[model samples]
Structure formats: C-alpha cells, structure tokens
Target: MIFMTVICTNGFSRPNTDPTASQQRTSILVLNLMPNKQGTEDQIISLFEETNLPIALTFMYPKSHVWRHGDQADLAENYVSLDDISDQYFDGLLVTGAPLEKLDFDDVDFWSEFNAIRDWSQTHTTTQLFTCWSAQAALYTDFRLPKINLEDKIFGVFENQLLGTSLPQWFQIPQSRFSAVDRTDVLNCPAVSILGDNQATGPFILKANNQNTLYVLGHPEYNADTLSTEYYRDLEKHQPVKAPENISLTAPQFAYAHWRCCSRYLYQEWVKQSFLLKENNSHEQKQLQF
Candidate 1:
C-alpha cells in the first residue's frame, strides 16, 4: 500500500506518517510568484497531497520582488529567500504563475532575478514544472518565442484535447490570461512537444523532449471559485474585463470542478517521471563507480 505524506515547515496541515511505507520522500521547491500567497499555497499543497506520493514542499519567494499584498513578516518567516536556497538541491521545482502578464518580460522588476532562478534550476533541480505566465516566460527564455496579446482575456473553463495518452482524452482546464505563445512557434521548435491543445486556447500543455521540464499553459490547479473570484475582483477594481465564458455569473456554485481528476493525473505523472529519472541517474552513477 502506497501512502502519501506532505511535510511543510510552515503552518500548513501535515498528514499522519505511515510506518509501513518506505520510500524516499521527493523534495519539491516552489517559487510562488502569485499575489494571493496564502491561496496559492493552499492550492499547490492540496494538489501535492492528492498525488499520494511522499513529498516534502519548500516554499520560496524572490528577494528582488517588492511585496504589495499580504503580510511581509509572514513571508519572511514562512518562505525561504532566493539567497537561502542558492546552494540547495531539489528533486523537483514548481514555479507558479504571476499576474505580470501584461508587462514586457524585461520590464518586470524581478526579471533579472527570475532569469537567475531559471538558469539555476537547469543544474540544481532534476525536474521543473512551470504554469501559466511562468510557462510563457520559460518559452520566451528558452526558445525566443514571443507572447501575442489577445484583444480579450481567455477567461473561462476550456475543454482541451489531450495529444498524448498520459492524461485523459479530453479534460476541462481553466484559463485566465491576456497573452499566449504562438502555436506555430511551439510546433516549429523541435525540442518541445505539445501534450494538450484547445481549439481557442492553442496549446494547453507542453513538455521538453528530454522530459525534465513540463509547461502547463492553463490553471488546472484552480479551485471551483477561483474564476468567479477573479471575475468579481476585476469588476470591483473597474478593470476592463468581461464575464468569464462557460461559467454562470448569476450562480457561481454551478462552476463545478470538472478538471480535478485530470489535474491529479497530470501531477502524479510528473512525480512518477521525476522518480524514474532519479532512479536512472542513480543507476548510471553506480555503473560508473565500477
């Protein structure tokens, strides 16, 4: 019987340990760039727990970024600074999406720091997972792919067709973005493969040919109310935002999470692949010692 465990030093919930299970816990370092720090933490931690794998999570924030929302004291106490983990290693790295999609890559305050972390991850981490804007950032940095701004935001629950058999044939994924990478550019790049695609949203999931990196272009980790929250938040702020498609504004409860299963499947697959890569590397090291 496989047992899952999540160890977070912060004040988050910790599950009971199983004595029978004996597996090396995978360490995942998350560089969360989201404005709602606590909400993003909850969403990511819940996803890791559902994977049923022994995992240890370490949350990180950029020192170069200025905090506008949330308590600064809590951040300093709970999350590690970039300088804190510069010499550390992890089995996996997860970089969350930020709200900096509207600005040019070079215009962001932490662009240099972000690039430093991205470059560091290449050698320090075994596997990397990037979501939403971070996915766009990775594509731009690695492939020089430009982001095309849409006249309207792709805000809604979208049904995406899976190009690979790793996940279900079709699944719903939530998208809330004003920019996207060109599909032709992604297809033209030989080093990347599109795992999932949507008719309106273009490529939803992409993987590097070497299998060390995964890019998720949508918010599969989003809660049922996430879209609704964003919609109302924008309206309250008087931003030029339209109502999210395929979701009812009158009855927000109708936004059932149809993509939860797919989200779990995708995360579990990533963990499994990371473990496989670790094992193969270990085997190679032992062979070389002979």
Candidate 2:
C-alpha cells in the first residue's frame, strides 16, 4: 500500500522523499508536451501513487514547437528551460504525449533537444517510459518508422495486456490517443518489443531491447473524468469524436461515468525489473526486504 509521490511544478522536480537516504534516488524526467502544463504533470504523478520507491519528476517543454491547439506556456509551474537542463541527469524518464502530427516531428522547434534527452537516456537513465504521443515521438526518432495518422480519434478506456513475468506478457498500458502507431514486424526491430496491442486500437504497450525503456500507447494516468472532459470539449468545438468502441453496453453515454484506475502493480514491477538488471546484488537485498 506504500506509494511513491512525485513532485511536479513549473519546471524542475525530484521525488518527494521524507528524509536522509543512502541509496541513489530514482529520478524521472517528464517531457511535457501539453498545453495544460500543471494538469499534465498531475496526470503523470497519479501513476506513482502506489509505488513505494522514491521518484522525482522534471518537466521539459518543447519551447520551439508550434501549437496544434491550446498553449501551455502560461500554465507551467516548474518548467526547466532547455538551456537550464543541458547538464541534467536522471535514473528514469517519462515522455508525455501531445496532440501533434507525426510527420511534423522533424519540424518542431525543440525536436533536437528532445532527441538529445532520448539519446542520453539510452546510456544514462536506468529506465524510460513513453506515453501515447510521446511513444510516437520516441519511435519516430529512433527508427525513422513514423507513427500512423488516424481518420478518427481513438478515445476511451482501452484494454491492454498485463504481460506477465514469463515468456509472453510484458506489462500493462493505458492508451488514449487520436492517432495510432502503425503495427510493424517485430523481427525488424528486436530492440523494440511490442508488449501489448489492442484489436480495436493500435499498439498499446512497447519497450526497447534493453528493457529499460517502456512505452504505453494509452493514458493509464487519466482520471475517471478525463474522457468526459474530452467529450464535452470536442462537442463544444464541434469536432466529431465518435463514442469509444468498447464501452457501450448500457446507455450510449455510459463510458463517461465509468472511470479507470492506473495499474500500479505494473509500474512497480517494471521498476523492480530494471533495478534487478542494473544493480544485481543490491537488487536482491531490496527484494528480500520486500
């Protein structure tokens, strides 16, 4: 029942630990590409509520990017300007998704800077997780295989595989995005493993070869009311977002009332796996304590 609380403000964040510590803290840097800066940070933090380990979150805004919709520049609280983060380091990285066109990644203003962090995470951070659009961003940057554009937005509480610890299953995922990533042959990129996929949606979860990096194509961090908020917003804007596919067993608007909770077990499990591979002997001792 122990939870790891993450502190997020305008720019910089470190885990909100109680006191003195001997072990090296696990830090998570979130590349927030949302217009609602503080809200984005809050959604990501919701995921760490059940984690017992220490976690810190830092925000990296794409200062150079053009807005596809709203602007988050005014709402940011703990934002770290690109120049200020040039020498930063962390143990974990969580890339937040944004509503951006996939083909335009190369044209974003801060695209280069985000690429630097992604490249650094490979060797520096113990683990990395890409969410929704961020997963698209990472895949686009890594393999040159672009994220696919969709005819309609895929919005709902998606069912993702909680790939168990054995041969097949890898983890759990929450995917809430308009566009979906195109499925590719796993053999092409052994480094990129497709952990989960939705028959209705696209890739729901993925990870790199080293297993340090994880990606969720949906929004597991979304609160019960998130989908409702989107529904109202789209309706007002007159953007025709159809009712999400799976949830209409009852009334047509029923999915709005049905809320989803984040999968804490999967996150904590991933952390344990990464810690095991990174710090062998120490990891065993930690497990013993657990």
Candidate 3:
C-alpha cells in the first residue's frame, strides 16, 4: 500500500493517505487578527501538521488596519492582501481572535472591511471557523447576539463537553479572552446550534448549516506556552493578570501541550467533512450533466 505525506512546519508524522484517493488539495484562507501574525500562523498550522489530507493555506490581513505585528517586508512577501482574495472561494476559512474584545464591534479599526470579509465568507467559503473575538463579531453581525465582558479574563486550559454531535467527543481547549457570550444567547440564535459548553466558560462551539459555519470561543490552536507568554507580557506591562489554570506559571517553563491531540483531531475532521461535501457537489453536478 502506497502512502502520502502531509506537509507541516511542525515536525510530526503525517497520517497515512490512500494512493487511490483523489489528490485534489483543500484551499484554506486565514484572516489573521492577532497582534502577532506569525505566531497565529504557527499555532493554526500546527493543528494540521499530522493530517492525511492535502491543504494549501493563504494568510490575509485587513488592509484598512495599519498595525505592524511582524516585519513589513516579510508580511508583504509572504501574505496576501484581504482585498485580493475577496472574490475568491475556499474550502475552509479561519478567522483568528483579536485582542480588541473590550472595544465595540464598530469601534474596531477595520470593522467595515472585516464586516465585508465576513459577509463574503458566507457565500464564498464552504466552511467558516470564527475564533474568539471573530466569533463574537460574527454573532453580533449576523444574529445580534451581544458579548458580555468578563470582569476577569478567562485564561487557561478548560475542559469542555460536546453538546450537539459526538464526533469530536470531549476535549479541553486553551482560552485567553476577556469577553464571553452567554450560553442562553447562543441558544436563542436561530442560525446557530450549541456544539460544546463549559460550566464556567459557557458555550465554546456554535454550529450552523450542518457545521459549515462554526464559532469557536476558545483557542484550540494555542500551544502550551502561548498563554504563559501572554501572561508574562501582561506582567511586564504592570497589568494585573492571573496565572493560567492547569499549567505552571512560577517556573516560566514549557508546559505540556495538552490540547494538541484534540486540536489536530478536530481540524482533520473538518477537512474530511469539507472534502466530502465537495465530492457530493461534484457528483450532483455530473448527474445534472447526464
């Protein structure tokens, strides 16, 4: 039996791929909203490192916002402008979380442009995954769901249970957000179905259109020390911040990547479903041709 390798920056073994299967690659577009674009890219990329499917990722940044997260020269050469891909379609779309959760949706620097991009994703992309602030933004933009600001940040690894479907089963995710949406609000949204929930952090996943649209409230892509780094950064600024739960903060060392297994599993499942939908659509098109 012949096997194919999945390419990823992280040095992990790829799942076996059937040689007879179609080699069509899945195209994924990421809208990076974090302050550190490269870090966000690496976190998201690590999730698919061990997948069996072929994927091509395109990174996009808001043209209206002028913040420097990394070297401008490198960003220009490596990433595509959001405007360039507005009219294009992708198999998967990922919208990363931002640090501006305290600000009103309209107050965001690139709110209008981000709104346009969000609108475009509804029809142009097969599956959309909105994380953290993007998830809150989508809820507000599409369903009028309001986000409640937590007095303290929800920073740490928290356990969550699946609510809707059982494919993902159960998992824990790393969260570092200052705002949260009420489980009741998600329950009230006509277009969304709650997929996962936590007693303390409320709902995590909101699904719509048979999981074609997903609102993930936590950062499943975060590496173990991602939170630790953020915590120390906040400390340096003299901001009052608490240590991440389930991980050591005093040692300031590398923490175990407990979320890695579930993160990879969820991403691979999404890729599998996206390909299945594409295949079904092709079959229907061919049937129409006959």
Report, for every candidate in turn, its global Cα lDDT versus the true structure: 0.78, 0.60, 0.72
Which pairs clash inside model 1? none
- Model 3: how far residue 139 lies from native, Å: 1.5
Whose TM-score is greatest here? 1
Candidate 2 TM-score, C-alpha based? 0.76
Off by over 4 Å in 2: 1-24, 66-77, 161-174, 185-187, 248-262, 277-290
TM-scores of all candidate predictions against the true structure:
0.88, 0.76, 0.84
Error of 1 at 138 (Å): 0.8
> In order, how many clashes per candidate?
0, 21, 0
**lDDT-superior candidate, 1 or 3:** 1
Q: Rank the candidates by TM-score, best first.
A: 1, 3, 2
Ranking by lDDT: 1, 3, 2
All predictions: root-mean-square deviation over Cα?
A: 4.6, 5.2, 6.0
lDDT of model 2 at position 36: 67
Candidate 1 lDDT by residue in tens digits, 54-77: 877778898888879977777777
> What value of lDDT does candidate 1 attain over all alpha carbons?
0.78
Off by over 4 Å in 1: 1-4, 11-23, 162-165, 249-255, 282-290
lDDT of 2 by residue, 196-243 (tens): 766677666766654466667776566555666777788899988775
